[model samples]
Target: MRILQKYLKGGISSHRYKQYIICSLLALFMVGGVCGEYFTNCSSLQPGQYLCTEVNIDPRTQQPRGCTKEGWAKVLCTSAPGIICTETNNGTFEREIPCKYTNGYSYETALLLSVFLGMFGVDRIYLGYYAVGLAKFCTLGFLFLGQLIDIILIATQTVGPADGSHYVISYYGAGIEVIRMDNMTYRMPQEDWGVVGRGIKEL
Candidate 1:
């Protein structure tokens, strides 16, 4: 009975630690000024598809004219002159992303990677914090200062450098395939043997 009790207690402790780790990561992402729910999370466009039509609105007649991906053009709005509906993610251009997030990068992996690498500022570097990342690594994590801050920020979901004004990536691979939202046109993904492009189902 004593042995069983000890085993149960250990299991409980492990579970608690797991939860704590998850909470910490989300916190860091939030602090990074990259907390976006609309564009970041699963893309709004479908895979293997592209917008073919363009929409235009008539201010005088209070009508909308637009085109669809099927090469069929139509009005911008029906009766609602002030409202217009146009495709947000046209899925015309492809994007390139690291093959790790959904495939393997999990809460546990993130925790371990950020902690050990923060000492060398490796995580920051991935986010394009080249100078800071280099400085932190050189300072040995600011004598552990950098590591501590990284932990807190990471826990609070605040460890990002912003993906820019366009293509907000809010969620992982969920609603849409490998999302690639960008205001400007982008070339098709053809790196590492055409693994990345238009939309990746699982690559």
Candidate 2:
């Protein structure tokens, strides 16, 4: 309290006061950055719980489609039909594969930040693109053109977290549907391989 009073009362030199303020702001920024990295609570989900990967939106109504009216689509784990599987707490059978992990980054947050602060490069910095952030900052978001481009990219989810993590959006929110490919969904064409081998033998 005494030190703060001294600074406030102008007991410290102006140069020292400015330095102190700058240092304080920098410290706060660093702490905020660290806290922001872990803003999501996806880790709290249990084994039986599921995460919504995508929400399909209707073109005409601009609302979510399928599943519940709130767009709560239950993710199902699939495997070979005959394979034994343990029933989850939700009364559904799921394979051993775990749900996708999230790193606390949010799609809505990124898009909003890009729309509002892209000119200052805050969006790129928040997404962990230090180099691009610095460039944007120096160029004023490339004279604002880069800012506009970033807005589109973020809205479409073309740019994501630096660690290659997916954005954590609300299950009820509108999002583009993504088809997930798994071992059961994909298989090598044995007939095609056999035909190629026969052709090689004839040659």
**Top model by lDDT, which number?**
2
Lowest lDDT sum, 10 consecutive residues, model 2, at 35-44
Give a tens-digit lDDT track for model 2, residues 47-143. Answer: 4444343445434333333333233433444322222233432323422222223466778789998999999899999999999999999999999
How does candidate 2 score on lDDT?
Answer: 0.65
> Which portions of model 1 show Cα errors greater than 4 Å?
1-111, 165-203
* lDDT (tens digit, per residue) of candidate 1 on 41-145: 122334332242333433321222222223233422121112123333322222222121221123333346568788898776755568878998899889988
Clashes of each: 32, 0
Candidate 1: clashing residue pairs, number: 32
TM-score per prediction, in order, is 0.30, 0.43
What is residue 16's positional error in candidate 1, in angstroms?
Answer: 78
lDDT of each: 0.47, 0.65
Q: Give the TM-score of candidate 1.
A: 0.30
Regions of model 2 farther than 4 Å from truth: 1-94, 97-99, 177-203
Give the CA lDDT, 0 to 100, for residue 181 in model 2. Answer: 89
